[model samples]
Target: MTTLFKAPAKDKAALEEGAALSPRFDGSGLVTAVVADSHDNEILMLAHMNEEALRLTIETGIAHYWSRSRNSLWKKGETSGNLQMVDEIRFDCDQDAVLLKVRVGGADATCHTGRRSCFYRKVVTDGGQTRLEIDAEPRFDPTTVYTDH
Candidate 1:
């Protein structure tokens, strides 16, 4: 693949203030990616990106991520038709993380579970026990939408 990003600046000043985008990847060669809805700013999911995923996102204007669980690169919603069209991309001052504002297509879902967002559960404590409560409804049925699931 073609090289699209510069090597991270060694000096803190250049890294923080420079116009060049030099992402500081972690020891695992990945960077954190926070995705959100462009219109409402609803957080959709948290993902990771390797160099290639970042490059593809920039070039294609679509959100691409590194799947730590699958050990592979993933194009968001490629299978379920929930593609995330990136509206904007921003990096933290330290360049260790990225934020993608996007518009979701199809079912407007971002979670593999067919939910509108991956963060569909809320942590709650009841009777001294911690449990998860459903905060959002699924937009589509996973069994019907994703044959592989």
Candidate 2:
């Protein structure tokens, strides 16, 4: 892809409030991406994006992330039909991270485990031990949806 966004520069004003989309990637050539529901602003998932993923998302107005586990680029909901359509993209103070407000398409789910959001579990302490509590129910069935897990 052509260079649509410039690399982060030294100008404070430009870095903070500039028209140029200068994203500061980490040493791994990644920038943290936080996805949220556009209607309710509820956080869906946290992922990372390489330059190629970032470019596709911007060009297509869809959510694309670099799958660290898979070590490749993937469009969210491609397999499960839970595609996230970009409504807006915001950057952190230093531009090291991004927040994507999206309108979920298809099943309206974000997690591969068949939940509306990846953050379906809540951390809890019980009997002096930390555990996860199921805060949300599964919106779909992973068994029928994903084959590889």
Candidate 3:
């Protein structure tokens, strides 16, 4: 059977170098992207995974990310229980970014405002005036979605 985690031929050298030089959380500047997924192609969410997050994701099969805004580590669905179950991870040819296809579990949406995804809204210009409109309703209310523990 074919393995999903096999290193690409092109990335083999870099992976080896990274493993040797910066093995553990040294941020080797390799692995520029992470594409997580469940069985299907539904994208639960998309986030940048740094070296630490990448290692953790590979080790645990859970989505971990580097929060640019929070400037810290973030495990997906930690607070909302809308966990992203990673089925597979893939990289682009250039290894610049990742496409995360994941299974979104629980009631919470991927969007911060509690929408199904951050792409829930579509921008349009009316009479040459740009206006933001509600293209889609929130999949679930975050307040009720997450119970206090």
Candidate lDDT scores, in order, read: 0.94, 0.91, 0.61
Displacement of the residue 36 alpha carbon in candidate 1, Å: 0.3
The prediction achieving the highest TM-score against the true structure is 1
Give the higher-TM-score candidate: 1 or 3.
Answer: 1
The runs of at least 3 residues in candidate 1 whose Cα sits more than 4 Å from the true structure, single-residue gaps closed, are none
Query: Could you give candidate 3's per-residue lDDT for residues 1-149 as a string of tens digits?
Result: 22224333355557544432232222533344444345555444556666667777767877788887777878988888777767666655434456556777776467666876666556789898997667768877777755662
Root-mean-square deviation (CA) per prediction: 1.2, 1.4, 6.5
lDDT of 3 at 84: 75
| Alpha-carbon lDDT of model 3 | 0.61
TM-score of model 3 vs. true structure = 0.67
Best by lDDT: 1
The CA lDDT at 140 in model 1 is 92
At residue 32, candidate 3 shows an lDDT of: 43
lDDT assessment of candidate 2:
0.91
Please report, as a residue range, the 10-residue window in candidate 1 with the lowest summed lDDT: 140-149
Total residue pair clashes for candidate 2: 0
Q: Which residue pairs of candidate 2 clash?
A: none
lDDT of 2 by residue, 1-149 (tens): 59877879799998988877899998999999999998999999999999999989989999999999999899888998889899999888889999999999877888888889999889999889999889888888999999876
Number of the candidate with higher lDDT, 1 or 3: 1
